[model samples]
Target: MDIDNIAAKAAAKIDAVRDARVNAVKTAAASSVELQEAVQLLAAAEQKYAKDYQAALRADWTESDLRGFGLDAPSKKAGGRPKGARTRQSKPANDAASEKELIGTTSENW
Candidate 1:
């Protein structure tokens, strides 16, 4: 009922909220580390599977035979630039000359 008692109750509530937020952040960080480890394991397993598949092919196992047994060929992993990667376009050899011509400035002026 008093101002001091009311302030104390509000402070306690705020502290509880802050503690919950901190715990949530800690939980997310722990989950992220676990996910990263799992992803690494998955990539290693995929690489090993691809290698074994290639070996089977080299040992005279035809793709059709593998498919007949329900074992499809390993998919090719994307190897080129990542999505949204910026690439610089090569300028033409006469780019400067074209620019000068567009601005009506001849080589004699320089």
Candidate 2:
């Protein structure tokens, strides 16, 4: 065969390989996006189901029933300071004058 024919055949083969690679990559990227969306949807559904299940349990059972299952009753607040936080009482006006007399004037002296 002529050099021109051989060169044309090789070029065609290279183009075919490149087109196949591009298609494969596009397919994989599309599939990855679809899979990610599905995963997120599944996670949301699982969370909703868990919350609904807890509400159902609360409606059907008493606090003692949960304790029997080795679960503590859900706290009024999830995770924060208790209702009545203990605060230090401020010094009284009379005590403030006496404090300065007992303790030195400056913090360094105290």
| lDDT tens per residue, model 2, 1-110 | 69999999999999999999999999999999999999999777666655554675769976578678775644332333566889999999899998987676566675
> Highest lDDT among the candidates is held by which one?
1
Best of the candidates, TM-score: 1
Q: What C-alpha lDDT do the candidate models reach, one value each?
A: 0.83, 0.76
Where does candidate 2 have its weakest 10-residue lDDT segment?
72-81
**Native-to-model Cα distance after best TM-score fit, residue 96 in candidate 2, in Å:** 14
| Model 1 Cα RMSD, 1 decimal | 11.0
Model 2 lDDT on a 0 to 1 scale: 0.76
User: Candidate 2, TM-score vs. the true structure?
Assistant: 0.54
| Alpha-carbon TM-score of each model against the true structure | 0.61, 0.54
lDDT of 1 by residue, 1-110 (tens): 69999999999999999999999999999999999999999887777777777788889999898889887777754233566989889878699678868677655566
